[model samples]
Target: MLPRIHSKGNYQKQAQGNATARGNTARSHSSVRTTDSSKFSKLKEVLVNNLLKDYHRKNKKAGNDAIYLKAVEEVEKILTHGRLTDKQLKDLQRKFSAMDGIPEAAAVSDHAEQDSYPRRTEVDEVNSYRPQPPPTASTQTSPSKRRKQIDEWSVMTLYNDVKHYEEQKKMKEKVKNEQQRTREELAAQIEERKKQKAAVKEQERRVADEQRKKYEEWQQEMKLIENEKLQKLLEERKREAIELKRAQDRKKMQIEEDKKMRARATMEKRAQYEAVLKENEKVLERKRQQKQEERELDERLFRVQMEMAERQARTALAAENERARREQDRQLRLKAAERMGQEMENKAAEVERNIEERVQKAQDEQYRRDMERERNDRLRHDRIVKENNAFLQRQIQMQEEEKMRRKEEERLLAEEMKREAEAFKREQQRNKVLRHQQCMQQKAMLDKQRMMKDYYNENESAMTEIELRLNAPLLKQVVQEKPDLPGELASKINLN
Candidate 1:
């Protein structure tokens, strides 16, 4: 078994040496096989190292530490396996390229071709290692050097073919990764929208509850204010009625005192008039007696009769004067009573008018306040509803725009995928053509080598007889010509 080596520099050295000596050296089959195995191993080691470095450099900033560790583990496994198949190399290439956008290792073109040309295993055969030959005296290089150049060309061609396969695999994997990422992003957006809807509903419910609570509180406050106003108005009206009653009673008492003083003055004037009438009656009697004595005896009886009639007339006049005074006193008493009643009626009417006016004023004020409060509440409710509607409309518009943008992105992605598929198909056809050409060339070379070996085997005995017949005369001639040669030349020929 071949010893496993891990160092990069050593792998490179071994690869260079094996590649240079591949088909140029004249060595046994076992020696050639060993070199081939080592060459393939070195290629795998170099490819894995490059992939690892690229992955680390690109993903380090992204913080994909676990992914990097897994990659390292996978690389270790491949190295320990001691052999890398075309399929395994392709798989690794896809994973490495997709993970970090780094290019993958060279691989076989197809599964069928990979199975046909499987990697060779290291055998336990003991063969001596060969060193390259030194330059000859001739200025021209050896045929072995020319053959080595051709072998190197073939190896490079094989590496290019494998690289093409790896590139194709990586591209496919990268596309798949992009599609998956897009799906995840869409799902996250949908979840976010749902959460926003739930939150909006909760907010609206809270707002409605707050409004209801405020309205109820406002109603309670208004009721309290109205009740207080009613109490105050009732108390004020009661105070005003009491004041009016007190004023009416004061005026009525003043009118009654004035009537009593007038009645007493009228009684004193009647008694003074009666005393004056009595003094006048006594004087008139004395004058009538003197006139009778002077008239003489003949008319004495006639004068006495006249005096009696005069006394009767005087008595009737006194009776008529007394009745007129009594009738006048009765009329004055009736007028005073009527005036007092009229004054009382006027006061009662004025108080009624004042009370009606105050009540009407208070009712109008209350009605105006109620109207203003209702107007304010209506305006506030309208404003709140308008704001809510506008906000909902804006949210809906934004969601629609986002959906349109996502649709555009998906459409573009699909078109890009279609283009990639077509390009991949064309590349596969081209690689198939190239592989076929290389296969034909190899078959032709192998056929030519087999024909040359058959020709050499078939002509061997005949060529030996012909060469003897031809050399007999040359030998005779050389012997004859030997006597004419110099001593050193002759000695050398004799020794041979």
Candidate 2:
């Protein structure tokens, strides 16, 4: 049972090895599979000879014969069994070691191992992970004592290449960063624009709301105004109607009063006309009675006048006869008296002639004395009248002068008193004016203070009013007394 298990495990290992070998062979000969077997072998030989010569040149001291034998053995094993086991690989390595000057053959085996199992290096792994660096000048320069200069140049070139690469990388990074920033900025700006548009829409809505509110307010105010106007118009119309009613009432009252007055006047006129008619009838009756009495009186007067005229005529005739007789008698008596007077006058003339002589002498003496006495009396009376007249004239002149002096003194005194009164009045007026000015200034100050202050009292106003009233009375009194000069002067005269 152990042998069977061992054998089975060995068989599986062999089968896996055969499959790996066949896959390698088929992959190696895949290019030449389309050619004839002879040509394929010849191409394979040429490739192997070229590979060996390259290996020999890299290791000059390597024995070519030993390397060729080892290569032929490897070819035979691949041709016969199509594979080489680990033991067979070890045997071929020993064969290469047994040969002299076959260092190239070992190197070939090492190269084969390297090809099968590649080793990872830091440079290779770094190259794979990172990017490739540009070629530097050092790689192209010949090896010499001036190699350091080449190295420096290579280092500078390498630095420049690295710097350029870094710059390009930075530039790419910068470009990418800028693109990202630009995209972000665009997005942010779009968001901000959306916010601004929303804000503007809100503002517009608010404005529209405010406008609507204002319009509503305006409409309400207009309605109120219209109502007020309508009320005012209605009130005015009512007032007009009331006035029209009042006017009509007044007109009716006036017409009624006029009718009453006219009726009263007509009644009074009719009464007056009836009274006038009665008075006219009475006057006519009285006139008729007077006419009758006048006619009777006229007839009586005419009879009396005729009888008296006849009696007068008869008396005149008797008187004429008596007058004739009396005239004759008077003539006779006058003639007798004349004769007697002539006789007496003749006798008296004789006696009177004697007495006339003495009487004439006496009369002449008396007339002379009388004439002298009359002239003396006339002279005395004239002297007395002149003396009285002169005395009275002197007294009158003295009185007149005294009266004139008294009148002048009174006039001067009155004028002085008037001037003094006027002066006193002026002084009072000036003092009053000053007082008024002070009062006005005080009032103004008080008013200013009151204006500056927050409150006022009634006392100040009452005091101001009292002061004004007092001043008004005083001024009125002064003005009223100013025109009393003529009346005052007239009152001073003594008529007696």
Candidate 3:
């Protein structure tokens, strides 16, 4: 049927292809046993319909898994070899119709050709443990031959049962582990992204803070420079005022000296004028005009001095106000910067917390999903195994009953055999007890080995996870250093 399945596709392809122009040659499929076009066409239709039926399960959706893909490949191989018989094709069709995937028969047939699913090999291994049928009474010739045989490796029989249970556990655990690893990887990736984002934000914040600090320092330096300029201007203004004061004093002194000299000259002139009273009246009038000019000059000097003192006082007050205003502005800037720092810290911490919560949620969801999947697999496997065991038990019981029936009639005539049988039964009981003990010991050892294997596997996975995390930081650093590089290139650097 495998070849026929492929031949069906081939025939259709040929019919639609250039081969259709030729009549007899196109109708004949040399690689397959079924040369009849109509029967072969029916075979293909039946195979496709059966496969579709199997794939269209509970949800009425059709899809392929590993088993389906392997079956297709098997069909292709059968066609390629041109060795498929009619019997194999019919058997293959029956299997596809009866099973959702390959059956034990198909697996056995393909074992010599391909090893697709190895677990099916265990079906034979498990069957090997069935106790051999007891020998007939006719074969019992002597009492010495009746002693129970105890093989050294008889423990293996009991171990086989444990092995099967462990195999089932391993299968379920394998799928669960794969899902767990995927979840962990996803979570790690998310965490890594969060870390990178935070780190970048922090770096940017630091850069901005540094720029702000530098800017503030520059402002302070500029403020100090302005204050110095104001101070210099105030001192220069004071110096100008004092120079004006001195100049005014010097002018006043000069006026006083001139008056004194004029008065002295007038006194000398008055002594001379006593001789001539009429000539002296003109000198006295000139003296009065000089005194009026000196008085006016003194009043102007006093007014100038008072204005200079007021101007100096106003300049000092303005400089003091500017210093106070600058100090207040500095304080405001420092408070704002401190507030901004606190806000940034709070925001970063909040983002970190939210990310952690999200990660924990996802991890829980993944763990739940893995547990559910593992449970389903174990349940399904156990059910199938139970059915198979029940069927085998029925067959064995029927065989035992048939053998017992056949020996019933001969039991009365075989007196010597009855005694031998009694002895053999006693020995068999002893052997059974011994075998049970050995099997228990073997089970213990196997369980221990399984535990160790599981422990190591877990450790290996943990180490792998740790390695991934360790590499993430290096990768991030690489990306930061060469930001202009393509992302692929940057990641590859750390990967290497």
Candidate 4:
């Protein structure tokens, strides 16, 4: 019976041991489930907080706050899930630490409600439940330490990022202001260049104006010179014409003088020819008078010779007749001789008377011829004497008249010479009067001066002597004498 009681005790001990093993397994499984749920919830809370902070930081960098809020909503959706991978947990942890402080739970809840619908699930239980454990000094210290570390990392990263972004913004603003100032400076430089170009153009215009004025002045001077030259040339031509006219006048005067000389010569030659012709005519008249005288004398001589011949013949005839008558008477005379002798004596006496008468007639005729010839000679001599006497009288009259005219001329010349001498004497007398007047004036002046000088010396004798000599005249006497010649002889020596 003891053996059987021992076996039953062994079986009861085996069953108790199996029950304890099973209980331990179930407790371990429950613990694992709780831990997993707790871990997932923690990771979701980290993701949500980290996402919100990341969005704020990104928005600040991008300058777009609205897009940052949208990113936070997506994080809330992941936080509502009950499970998460290891990579997701690590990313959530890094992002959350970058946030300077934990985000508000109310803010996450309000955003989650606006974006998601409500639901009932096992994941919800894990999110809503809180775990409790017995407090220890070491455990409390560890959790506080971990939270402080995360907070410090977040504050450091946020400060550095915000500071860097502000620095970049200030640099960009400075660069933009500098670009605007440079543009203003370039515009001012362009305006200055335009002003310089205008000034240069004005200077060139002034120079051109000066040159035009100088050119006009030069043209005026040249015109004046040309006018002067033309005037000079005209004057020279006028002088030449005047000289030519003078030369022609001189030649004409010389020709007239030569013609006058030739005319005078011709007149003289004609006067000489006429004088010679008159002298020849007078000689021919004297020869004709002499020939007539000779012819008259020849006629008288021939008449005398014929008268002598006739008387001789007559005497001869008378003698012969007487003889014949005597012979006859002789024959008869014997008877009467005694009676006729007385008659013969008377006849001889009668013949003697007749001869006497004839001789007287011849003598009378010769006396008449001698008387006519003598009368003619006397008449010719008287005529010659009368012509000579008249010629002499005319010559004497001409000489007397010429002598009278010469004497008259001499008398006129003497009167003129006397007048000229009188005029010369008057001129000499005038000159003498002037000289005397001047001398008197000089003497008066000298006397006055001398009187003054003498008065100053208290003496008047020098002036008194000079006055007495000026008033006195010089004289000379002539003695009379008797005439040495007789009155008649002295009268014949009358003064010339």
- The lDDT leader among the candidates is 2
Span of 10 residues, lowest total lDDT, candidate 3: 1-10
lDDT of 2 by residue, 115-223 (tens): 7986643222212222224325654363222212223433444454456557766986786677456545544654575577578667756765785677578658867
* Candidate 3 structure quality by residue, lDDT tens digits, 1-496: 0001111124246224322323222222111122122243234334444434443443243323334445454454443233567687666655554555556676566665555554423223222222324544643455334433434333444354456557756975785576456546645665675577578667756765785677578658867976896698679668867975786577568657755765675566555444344443444455445445544654464445445444544554554455456556766665555565456556545755655565567557656755775576577557756755775576567558755754663464366457756876787587668657756765675566557556644543232333345445545664875589876556554564
Best-first order by lDDT: 2, 3, 1, 4
The deviation in Å at residue 84 for candidate 4 is 99
How do all models score by TM-score?
Answer: 0.23, 0.27, 0.21, 0.19
Encode model 4's per-residue lDDT on 1-496: one tens digit a residue: 0001111124245335433544443332221222322554344344544555554444432212222343334444444333458787557655543544334564476557757965533332343333323435765566433221224333444444345446645764565465345334433433453455456445544544554465456446645754675576567557756764675466457546645654564455445444544554564466446445644554464445445444544444454445446657566653344334334444444555555565556557656766775676567557656755775576567558756865786687579758866986797588679757866875686577557555644531222222223212210010113356556424433320
Off by over 4 Å in 2: 1-172, 262-281, 299-496
Q: Candidates ranked by TM-score, best first?
A: 2, 1, 3, 4
Writing each residue's lDDT as its tens digit, candidate 1 over 41-66 gives 33434554454554445554321333
Each candidate's number of clashing pairs is 1, 1, 1, 0
The global C-alpha lDDT for each of the candidates, from Candidate 1 onward, is 0.47, 0.53, 0.51, 0.47
Question: Candidate 1: what lDDT?
Answer: 0.47
Task: Mark the regions of model 1 whose C-alpha exceeds 4 Å error after superposition.
Answer: 1-363, 395-399, 419-423, 426-434, 441-445, 448-496
